[model samples]
Each structure stands twice: as structure tokens, then as C-alpha cells.
Target: MINMHYTACSLLKITFKSLLTFFAREEREDTMPNTEPKLYKLQKKDLVACILRVFAKLVLFSFHRITMEGLEHLPKEGPALLLPKHCTYGRDVALEAIALHRATGRYANFLMRAIASRFYEWAGGIKIARPKDVRRVPGARALNRASFEYIRWLYLQGEVLVAHPEGTRNPYDMGALKMGVIKHLMDVENEAGRCIPLVPIGIRYRGYWVPFSRIEVKIGEPVYADDFENIKHLLSYLREQISQLSGWVI
Candidate 1:
């Protein structure tokens, strides 16, 4: 009976998503003007994207009942890097995006895996290659470079970029950290001549074996780039801090 209920809910979610996609496409088609307007018009696709993201947040919050702490530590203004622990498949990304938006009233540009780029492209996300696979594909290499360039532009434009330095979901166990976050910070520092504030976010899921388990997100104080000797040490310290705060042993 529980399995049947879970299956029914999953099917309902898929049906809703299909309906949203159909309407979004129809809205985009209907808004086309032959003359080409002077200013770009926002289409239904944009609205659909926002609505879909909100739907995701509602589902997550309903299931997990996330309680956020230290949200006040995030800067009210200026570009910053939000580094969160990777967990629970990809749900953490949605959790962080929604939480950050709620706190700052600014949408975060998440640095997502290249594989998820197509889905996120619709929602205005920047895709970065997993550092391990950066050397495998030529196109990925280009995309990685382009992704960094875009991130740099966004930072200068004063937007927050959320990155997961662990590179992949760690399944609640400690995993080796990647250097993409460090590299991006160093580049930004070189261009801006100062390190951007790095906010460490820790997400914990209660009862992974149970369906619709609770989630807790702890946002830590922003760590300034100048506090560490170099990018390596900075990332190491950030990892340790996040682990300590989240009660996850690294």
C-alpha cells in the first residue's frame, strides 16, 4: 500500500511536469511577433521556469521540512560564492537555490554538472564540467572555460554563484574535495584584486531510508578570501568548517 501511494504520487508529479512543458511551449509559440520588437519580451517559458522551480521548493519543503539557520550571515549585497555540501542526489541544489533566494531576494546562479545543463539552461544556470572529466571531451573543455567566463561576468555584475566543491553527491560519507571552487575564487580575486566572500552551507538529511524525510540546512558565516594563505588552504578550511557545522565527519 505504501509503495502504491509512492508510485501514484510520482506519476502525478510527472503528469504535472508534462502539462507545464506543453503550456510553456505553446506560450512561447503564441508570443512570436513577425516584426521583431525593439526590446526582448519575456515569454511564458520564463514564467513556467519560475513556477516549476517554486513547485520544486514546495515539494521539498513539504517532504523535508527544512529549517535554515545562520541565514542572516549571507550578505545582503555584493557577489559571493555559496559552497554547500553535496548530498541526496541533486535535491540539495534546489534546496540551496530556494533558500538563498528567500534570504537575499536574489536568484543564485548554480554551477551545475554538465550533464544537467540542458535542464538548467531553461532556468538560467551556468554549467561547469566535473573537474575529473574536464580532460575527456573537447566540447566539455570549451564549456568549462565558457562557464568560468560567464561566472566571472556574473560575479562582476554582483550575482551569487553556488558551487559544490565536492564535485558529486557523497552519500553522507566524507569524500575528496575538488578545486574548482578554489580556481574560480582565485580567478575572481585576480580580476577584482580581492577575494569574494565564501559562504559555507551545510545540508543534512534525516532518515535517508525513509521516504519524504526531513532536511536541515545550516548556513555559516561568510569566510573572506584574505583570511587564508592561498586557495588550497582556503578550500580546506571551508570544508572543515562546513563538516563541523553540519555534524558530518570529514
Candidate 2:
């Protein structure tokens, strides 16, 4: 009788353990959320737009020789801020856009000047309005908010964004860094509740007005959003990095 009782107890314990294991698996599955969102699945229309943009860039610019370094640094997936120093004549802008597209299989969205909206629209690029113009249009405040929301949306969708913190191109003189890029980074982090990586790019031109004179692009390490306390520190660090890489004294 004692042996029978012991066998029954062992069986009961085994049954309880099996039940606990099943419930534990079910609970784990319920708690593990999907981190990746399916927002960036490119539609047929997006592909067409990318093709057109590529064609335009190829036809419009006469790139004599382009050397890209640190291509391996670009992330294979996910959204990132592509920040490059702005040079005179808008060459850096074109280079940034093309390089990003080539490195990552996605078209780049730029935070363009208000006046360039029509041109960007024609080229099938996303246009972000300037602060001054927000006052002119009806419901401008809402539009401004919406534009940023769209930026975050694009990021969530796994698209690349190239922004020049210096609102205007510098003439290779004093390294005057602006806060626009840092502001965008902070805004994105605030909305996403996670720090996005920043990719620093350096574009060097051998000579101005000399086509095919040799363009060198160096993509530096990624900077996390939480690395710096504020935008000032971030901008200062970026400016220094670009200056050092480009061999320019700021």
C-alpha cells in the first residue's frame, strides 16, 4: 500500500510540472512583443520613384571619380540619421543622397529649404518646410508638427534621412555647425522612446569647379542619441569629427 501511494504521489507531481511548463511557454509568448514594425514595405510606387531619382542624379551630375570609405559602417537594417557637413555649391547634398541610396537599398529623405519644396516635389523627394514659412501657411503650426511626425514615420519605416545641421553650406572657412540636426535627433528619440544611431559623413573635394577632380567620402562611426547631454555638445563633437576627418581646421 505504501509503494502504491508513493507511485501515485510521483505521478501527481509529474502532471503538475507538465502543466506549469505549458503555461510558462504560453505566458512567454504573450509577453514577447514584436520589436520590428512593418512600416517600410516599399510599394510599387516607391520603387518607381527611386528609379527616377537615381536616373536624374546620374544625368545631372558629372561625377569624375567618387571614392567612398567606411561603407561597412552603415547598418544593414533599420533607420538612422545620416549627418554630413554641408559644403558650398550643394555638392555634399547630392553626394549624401546618392551614397545613402547605394549603401542602403532605400531612397533618402532630406530636410530641405522651404524654397526647394517644389524642386523636391518634382524630384519625388520628401520636403520639410522651414520654420519661417510655417507662419505664412494656414494651420502652419499643425503642418510643422505633421512634417516632423512624417519624419519619424519614415524612420520607423526603415528609410534613411540625410540632414545638414548647418542650414547653409559653408565656404570651407570657419566650421559653423547649426543645431538643426541635433534637434531632429532629439525629436526622433523623444517620439520613438529609443536612441537612434547617427552616422557622420565627411565629403572632401580636391578643388572647386574642377569636375572629376576626385571626391572622397568618409563615413565615420555611429553616435548614439544618449551619448551627449544636449544638442550643443553633439554639434560640437560632430563639427570636430568632420574637421578632423577632412583635414580642415575649424
Score every model by TM-score.
0.81, 0.69
In candidate 2, how many Å is residue 163 off?
Answer: 0.5
lDDT of 1: 0.68
Candidate 2 deviant stretches above 4 angstroms: 1-45, 56-63, 88-90, 117-119, 122-124, 131-142
RMSD of each: 6.1, 23.2
Ten contiguous residues with the weakest lDDT in model 2: 27-36
- How many clashing pairs per prediction, in order? 0, 0
Tell me, by lDDT, which candidate is best.
1
| Cand. 2 Cα-lDDT | 0.61
Candidate 1: stretches off by over 4 Å? 1-49, 117-119, 209-212
